[model samples]
Target: MAILVTGGAGYIGSHIVRAFRLAGLDPVVVDDLSSGHREFVPDDVPLIELNIVRTKKLTEALRDHSIEAVVHLAGFKYAGVSVQRPLHTYQQNVQGTVSLLRAMAEHDIDKIVFSSSAAVYGTPDVDLVTERTATHPESPYGESKLVGEWVIAAQGRATGLRHTSLRYFNVVGSATDELYDSSPHNLFPLVIRALTEGHRPKIFGDDYPTPDGTCVRDYVHVADLADAHVVATQKLLAGQELEPVYNLGSGDGVSVRQIMTAVARATGIDFEPVVAPRRPGDPARIVASGQLAARDLSWTMRHTLDEMVESAWNARHQS
Candidate 1:
């Protein structure tokens, strides 16, 4: 039986697929190729081109691949755009999660590592968020992820499904040049794209309550993030119990201005970023402790801020 990765052709998902392969585990991919690239998937790995919402096809693929566990990373991932397209967000994230759960139930594939987001906390009141932090999702994307977590938890309680949700903050950097982040909405890609195209990157809001005015977010390397998923999946499949949720964070906050400066330093391109009004549903700051993940999944910040910027810059150029 092989492990299944939903949305495995996407940037982060592809990295996780690489991690699993490095660990000597076989992984089958199921991606619709909507936002994901068909080439991102390794040639040796099986790629099932289907959306998770198509429960029947997904179930068939699960059965065909003899899938033992699922690392679910598929969903609508844009937090800013989710505000304008709440219905689409819910349909993709919430309904998609429900359909995946149903398919898993049919196949008795009880193990799952859900790809959650820090948006579940919305604009947190705490300086450092923990698993115990109350959820107050501001955008439909955030709301849908929180609801997905709820649904998964409910399924676990009802069916004894072994599961865990990883609430990650801003995911950046890359493990390989061939598998760079391709999301047009992500900050790293946006900045890299702007600079490459001879345009100054724009900061969404600079008047926030952050130290540098721009928003403060917890950034974690995508490679490190992917490793944690593999570890989580291994532990779950081994019949080890895990926390219902864990935050994969660095326990440090970096503002948007800091990121831009790092980008300039890494790329040797110095240009002032244009300051624009804050996007709706944006928070001034939100960082997490990652203490739980560190203890359980051996999660740690293996890459520095400059390293993150440099690696991302290198990968984008090589790709």
Candidate 2:
């Protein structure tokens, strides 16, 4: 039985697809290509170019591919921008998720791994967030994701659907040069683009209470995150008991200043990052404990900060 990866042509989704393939699993892709690149998907994999919002077509594809599971990663995922485009965010994330769940039920595909976000926690009050952190999403994007989790839980309770949602902080680095992150809003891409254009990268704030006086946030390597997804899929298929949600995080986080230094070291760009006022609603720090995922999904930080910067820089330059 094959796994259906919605938005499998996108950055993180593409990485998960490659991980599945490397693990000798068949992964069928269905993407609308809204922000996904067709080239990211391997030529051998079946690519069904359809939107998950199209429930009928989505269900048809699941049945046609004989799919037994799904990895749902298709959604509009920009928290700040979601403030301006709330309707779009809700439609793509909430409505689209509902449609996907309905399709799964219709096709009797009960296993799934959802790509959720740390945004669901908003500005967490504690130093380290856990799976039990109170969800008080500050933006439409985050609210949509939390709502998506609820929808999945509701379906699981009613239909015996086995599901898990992986909530992650900043996802960085690349497994392959050809599959680098292309999100316009991601910090790595933004920094890399600025440096490549001979512009100074900007740091939003440096007066936070952290030791470095900058915001400290978890930044996990994309490959590590993909591996967790693969493991989660395997566990579900084997009927292993699992948590409804897991945070794939860096228990210790890196500060923005540290990231700037890493960028300079990796790209050989020697310029101080310009400091700006913190964006509204920006948290001072948000790190998560990944002990649960580590025990269950073999999660670990395999890349150093330097490695993450180097890999991202190399891919940015290569692309």
Candidate 3:
């Protein structure tokens, strides 16, 4: 009954892998050192250094290690990058997911905890969009993720493999340490990086309908987000009929301007951010209501915005 965590060496994947280990579960990891760190995974867990895109190698590793369930996280995720390289995004996210499913079905692994994204809901009309919201993804990255979900759903229906896709927005704060907090794409780290280098944090779209006229997003702490994954996976193991999709957010929407203010409050930095025009394909307000995860997974917010921001700042400085 070993859990096979794909991309376990990456930031969020490493946190989830560490969470599983901390909860008395030994997780086996399969990661190519593409965008992940080999040092992030604990020495105790078995590491099969192989690219999942290489189907034969991934299948060989799965059979060799007797992996029971998989937490699929290995994929390219930069939205702007995906825009430039749509084909690569499709191959990495969509094709990679199909390969994982084929290997799982072949090995008779019936359980999976998928890492879905909130990008599926691109520029929603409502303030707080729920899991039932219509998915009109505007970018190649979002399209790829939505397609990943489709692949899993289609496979799960044909085969009886149970799965739970947790759609997350923003994951901040420290899970293990500050060593893993230097991601270049996410907002929190982006701001911290700019401030650390004595550069102004750039804010896009400061004239929208919101109070600050900037895009808003939900920032869930990594630990609490990890906790949701644990609960979701446990439910699947218990023979529960997974909802197929659920939003894992705080239901509290924080604007970009508000995030800058929070950054200043959390880190005692007074550097102003440069107001830039709205980014291409940027969503104005993309906040998840997160009612389904709360009711079904029995999860709640364990950390505050201030706590999350401060922990992230502390992690940034400590590194």
Candidate 4:
């Protein structure tokens, strides 16, 4: 049975596809190509170009590919933009998840690995966020992801579906030259683009009460994140006990100023970042401990900050 990777043409999804193949598992891709690049998927892998919101096509693909489980990664993932487009965000993240769940239920594909987000913690006051943190989401994107979790949990309760959601922090770096983070809203891309375009990268606010007076966020390597997903899927398939949710985070976080410095060092572009006012709803610090994930999913920050920056820079230039 093949593993269905929704949004497999995307950055993280593409990496997961490669990881699955490396583990000797067949992976069938389903992507709409909205933000994903077709070239990212391997030529040998079967790519089904369709939106997950289309229940009929999704169900057909699931059955046709003999999919045993799904890695759900297709969704509108911009949190700040989601605030302005709440309905669209809900329709894509929440309703799209509902459609996927319906198809999974119809086809008797009872196992799923959901791609959740750390945004659900909204501006946490805690020093280190854990799975037990209160989920007071601040944006429609976060709320929709939280709702997606609830949808999966509810399905599990009603239909005995085996499921687990992986809440990702600020994901960066690349595992391969063929794939890189392409999200326009992501910091790595933004910095790389700015340097390539000969523009000074802008830092939101540098006056926050952090050690460097900038916001601190957990930045995990993309390869590390992908490895956790593969391990989680393996555990579910083997019917091993697993947590309903796990956080893939770096125990120690890097500050925005630190990121700027790293980018300069990696790209060999030394230019002062334009200090702009802090964006509304920006938190001073939000880091998480991946102890639980480490214990169960073989999660670890295998790449150092310098390694992450260098890999991302090289990939960006290669692309």
lDDT tens digits, residues 1-319, model 1?
5899998999999999999999999999999999999889999999999989999988887777788899999998998889899999999999999999999999888999999999899888899999999999988999999999999999989999999999989999988888888887889999999999999999998898878899999999999999999999999989998999999988889999999999999998989999988887677888999999999999999999999999999998998
Give the range of the ten consecutive residues with the poorest summed lDDT in model 3: 175-184
Model 3 C-alpha RMSD vs. true structure (Å) is: 1.4
Give the per-residue lDDT of model 3 (tens digit) for 76-143: 87877888999999998998898888888778898898888888887788878888899988789989
* Deviating ranges (above 4 Å) for candidate 3: none
Q: How far off is residue 267 in model 1, in Å? A: 0.8
* CA displacement after TM-score superposition, residue 190 of candidate 1 (Å): 1.2
Where does the lowest 10-residue lDDT sum fall in candidate 1? 277-286
Q: What are the per-residue Cα lDDT tens digits for candidate 4 across 49-160?
A: 9999999988887777788989999999899899899999999999899999999888888899999999999988899999999999999999999999999999999999
Residue pairs in clash, model 3: none
- List model 2 lDDT by residue over 190-223, tens digit each: 9999998989999998999999999899999999
Q: Candidate 1's C-alpha lDDT?
A: 0.93
CA RMSD, predictions in order? 1.3, 0.8, 1.4, 0.9
TM-score (C-alpha, index-matched) for candidate 2 = 0.99
Candidate 2: pairs in clash:
none
Which portions of model 2 miss their true places by more than 4 Å?
none
Backbone clashes for every candidate come to 0, 0, 0, 0
Worst 10 residues of 2 by lDDT: 59-68
